[model samples]
Target: MVRVATLLLLRHGRTTANADGGLAGRQPVELDETGRAQATAVGERLRSVPLAAVVTSPLIRCRQTLDLALPQAEPVVAEGLIECGYGSWEGQPLKKLAKEPLWPVVQQHPSAAVFPEGESMAAMSARAVAAVRAWDARITAEHGPEAVWLACSHGDVIKAIVADALGVHLDLFQRIVVDPASVTAIRYTPLRPFLVRLNDTGGDLSGLVPPPRKRRRRAARTTDSDAAVGGGAGAAR
Candidate 1:
């Protein structure tokens, strides 16, 4: 049987920049109080799942969320999963950026968009997807196909990964809404990838639990009379 691996993509909780509608970019921003509460709620929601590992972006916000949500699991910092650098636009307000000529391209045609003096959306998508695939393989190899792992990262990063899994073009990535501290899941199988859940903030995940193993039934032994009758019938035939 082909092995399957489950990946839980978690967006970090709200940050000061998030609340203020600023472009956090690759800035080292910490989670706000509301963000912390959200992270706690997410942690409580996922306490039942047997997470094999916790992977996260190297940024502080992502690290904070990982620490709050999956405190017990040692997080593996993945630089490739880091947020897209907005360059000169970093720490700027979204309202301000909305007036820029490139804003439309970013929202409508991300595949062709590039941040001023920063990375391109295509580059971001490629690296993020690569990082996720690598982690999925590593976790499945170490813990088996039934293993589930978490990846806590920025909103854009999570969206890119989800888009790749859904086979959506990067231009339509903006259409997918990923809220703060939301959880999305993708099941990677040999045949194809399945989007199990997306943007789920509250709900029971008991369904993700591995089903109980089925026991094999043994064949019943035949008595001496039954065996003699079977042999006589075979001889007559």
Candidate 2:
């Protein structure tokens, strides 16, 4: 049987930059008050899932979100899952950046757009996908084929990973929407990957839980007279 694993991609909760409408990029900004509540709510939403591992981006905002959402799990920092480096645009107002010519390319043709003094969208997608796949393999090997894992990362990073899982081109990745403190599930199998859920914030996930193992029924013991009858029938045959 092909081993299968489920990856729960969670976007970090709202941050100060998010509230201020600024691009946080890789800044060390922490989650805001409302973000804390959102984190707690999402944590409660996923309480039923038995996560094998909780992975997170190296960014402080993501780390904080992971801690708040899954307090018991020690988050494993995946450097490759960090947010896209916005470089010069870091901490800038989104409204101003929206007017720039490069912004259109970023939205429509992300495959060809490059952040000034930073990284390209394609590079970000490559690294994020690789990191997710690596963790999927590790979790499945360690926890079994039905293992479920959580990866707490940024919005753009999660979008990139989702785009790859859906086999969508990097240029079209902007069409995908990932909100703060949302959960998206992707199940990886040897044959093909399945997108179980996307941007789910208020849905019950009891269906995602693995079904209970079936109990094997023991064969009834045959009495001596019954065995003798069976032997006589066999001799007659």
Cα RMSD, each candidate: 11.8, 12.0
Give candidate 2's whole-model lDDT. Answer: 0.84
Mark the 10 consecutive residues where model 2 has the least summed lDDT.
228-237
Question: How high is the CA lDDT of each candidate model?
Answer: 0.85, 0.84
Question: Global CA lDDT of candidate 1, please?
Answer: 0.85
lDDT score for residue 42 of model 1 = 92
lDDT of 2 by residue, 181-226 (tens): 9999987766556677899988886566555434445664432213
> Could you tell me every candidate's TM-score relative to the true structure?
0.88, 0.88
Q: Candidate 1 on 16-63: residue-level lDDT in tens?
A: 999989999999889999999999999999898989888889999988
